[model samples]
Target: MTQVNKALTAFQVPIIDVTTDEAIFEGEGWDAVVVIATSLAEIKQDEVSLLAAHASQIDFRVGKSATLLFAPGLAGGRLIISPVTDSDNEYSDVRIFAKAAREGIAIAKAAGATKPLLVVPSVTDNRFANAEQVAALACGQELWQPLEARESKSLQPSLTAIGLLNTATHSLLLNAAESGRVLARDLCGTEPERMSAIGFAQYCVDAFADSGLAVSVVDQVEQLKAQYPLLSAVGRSSFDVARHHPRVVKLEYVGEGPITKTLFFAGKGVVYDTGGADIKVAGSMAGMSRDKGGAAAVAGLMKALSILKPKGIKVIAELGLVRNSIGSDAFVTDEIITSHAGVRVRIGNTDAEGRLVLADLLSHLRLQAQTAVNPQLFSVATLTGHVVRAYGGYPALVENSAAKKQGVAATLAEVGQLWGEPFEVSRLRPEDFDKIADKNGAADVVSSNNGPSSITARGHQYPAAFLIKASGLTETELAFTHIDIAGSAVEGDPLYGKPTASPLVALLQFSN
Candidate 1:
């Protein structure tokens, strides 16, 4: 293993604050000091000021509770964190754990602490006291925040539950989130060759199996063509690196139980968008490599679901993975590409390839919703600049129904500043869709006129909103909201206050 891994493995963790006396002591291989936050010692008056008083300090608080674990001589450093909850407490929706997890994790990451200690405040049982390193830990679901696009596990006496925020448990969750993030970053930030469609698909499949979820992948282009025509069309015209083999990747994660809900998650997996034959200016395409951030988000979310095994929730995330490279074999302008929904799209601009990829994926969701599950599903993607511009670095909204609108608003509110303000809803119908609906042609409105319109607040953002509705979703209460993360998905976001993937926050907000 690596050096960091070795150090964490060897390090002894201490869990304090368990007794009525509240004493400071050193045990064999572990040292600790327990203070009573519920008693006289609790930092009550001007607690934030008191914690800030210490030169080299560490302090944390959730709601009315406040805690400080500090040392005078440690100098300046970073903080690492862990989140813990109990099995019985998992369904409670208590504020303490979630608040603690989000706050603790953020502080730890921001401080750059080598190892974080999320001391779950509990008295019944000890989960992390003996757990070892992993992503995150849950005792009774006190604070079970799943960044599915970024999920978790436990450490200390590894695999056990944590009723209290145990140091070792926090370490494990910290490790897991960090490791998962690296994997996610690798999937997006690195060269596509290393994280190919097949390799990535296999990893996701393995994760599902390990977590007791059934996984299925359709890698052969012929199979994908037969079942998912839209995926094939967008991909058949594209190539993956050194091979001419037509690209097509499909994945499904099946959870246990009666499958109460089938949450259809789709992503625009354009591995690399070279603007095709139309090409793109260097400045306008600096980070085109991150075109696959949507897919990465989907992959990360799938990984988390597999690992956590959140019961009673059935989810299927679909990704349209392909590289829109510039070549003679490429599907250029003036090509009418039929969607999985069977709607014909005249390619407007190859730079607008994100739309084509999304068209197929959205069509798939529409087909599934129209044919199968009860019409209760949500589809997310890094689809448009219009949504991003409308939301403008805050939580934007484009709800198709009252349920989604209320659920999303309430969930975000509970997180307490975790997500930004949402954008207003923009309608998508056959009339508006037909106006800019050509595959071989660029949506002139989006290309030529982008400003505050009958729709969003400001900017040229028509393509995604217009075409997404064209998929099988009906004109009635069958709601649909398209998220265009043209400038939204990233590690460093000014509004979120740290390097983040945005989807996690969106998921939490949506779940509420």
Candidate 2:
């Protein structure tokens, strides 16, 4: 991420011809400025070390040519095209390939030419069309990242477009992604001491404010109790023990003039889950800081929605902001808790706290949406290992309503294509997913019929459908699509060497 001005030229990297054995000279200049290369062939690692050294110095001289300003290497069969439109061709602006195209734009523009040009070798289809995205890699580079770990982490791909039109579009997409990542940095760095429930809520509130979205925070135990009981209940115990207060966070993004269609999103924002009375073992609680991943994703999605400003869609979101820790007044197992929508739930295990938070928030969203035009509400969470184990971490689990004849399936397919991950949507017929301990104590209507009995009984897909339905929504019309990002929420890639941006792609797909 150095310098990408706008859409200019392209460096076509495909084999000159599929059948031809001929190739361009390694490090051959793509244009008067940019150099196309994979390696120097003669020297190993030397070129990479040199490039890394020259990455910072604006005055460093790699060549005697006046046009040469910055240097970036190329890959196989692909020659970096310079001056994308005039002498070269730009690649597709697809988000998946954006990392590649953006990198290319940055280096080419850095060339010393007064009006230095950047090029992408080939032209791509509409699937890759994003102007701001190109500019992000080309122009914003470091501005996008606000985390220690991701500061110098070179993301993959480069962007190259042709005129101002291409440049603008690429630049916008890049900024949107950067803006989202800055939110991610806040999410990724959640440590218990500094990143308490209140701190995390402040981070979310600030993000929405920066994005021009409206937000409200209910801070203090009494305020939290009067507003959000579930959030208050879980954290109240901890606050009394440590003398730290709790808060209830809500964000609303009003789109267009007078909302026409509305969608409600809810998340379990447990900044830290210590299992309260039912404690988690050392290893189980290791990554508890990431327990609030669902909250972070929801906040990120809200920011993306505000920036994109899709004219027709308006969204109302609720986050169950709290920390689940052990204390004298901690919520104990088997305790009957009343949710925002008045649904009575029996706490089977205190460790399964994400659902408790989600249950209350989900029920509340349904009620809120009922007052709007065509309520299309959904909930996302890192809830339940049953769905995770069912999908095997690669697939994203959505309820039967999601895969219905509606466009949800197609939209999901389009988004998942960006990162190339599997999405196995779990299908549900009825209340069959409810975990049944025995026919004796459980209510017959709520209990599952002869289904498999495992701790995996209540998966995110079916239970979400049921929870919303309990709020009086029909399976077909309610538009309840629950996404459990247990495994897919965070992705592990060798190329990235850490988790890449996932829920951003997922969230954009639905909201857009």
| Best-fitting candidate, scored by TM-score | 2
All models, RMSD in angstroms: 9.6, 10.6
Query: Mind giving the per-residue lDDT tens digits that candidate 1 earns over 1-512?
Result: 43322322232222222222111122211122111121222222233223334422333332223333453322122212233334246333332344445444444334443233333333332321222221132121122222222223332322122112332323333333333343344455544554455555544454444444445566676666765554454455553443433343444556556665556666776766666667766555556666676666666565555444545566666776676677666665666655566555565556566666666666666666665454444444555555555565533434444436446434433442323312344443444444564433442222212222324333323554544444545444444555555455653442222223445434533432
Against the true structure, candidate 1 has what lDDT?
0.44
Local accuracy by lDDT, each model = 0.44, 0.51
Question: What lDDT does model 2 reach?
Answer: 0.51
- lDDT of each residue in 367-463, candidate 2, tens digit only: 6776778666666666655666666554454644643556665567566544333356665555544442223443211312222212445454555
The regions of model 2 sitting more than 4 angstroms off are 1-168, 241-244, 392-395, 400-405, 418-422, 431-462, 469-477, 493-501
- Indicate the TM-score of model 1: 0.63
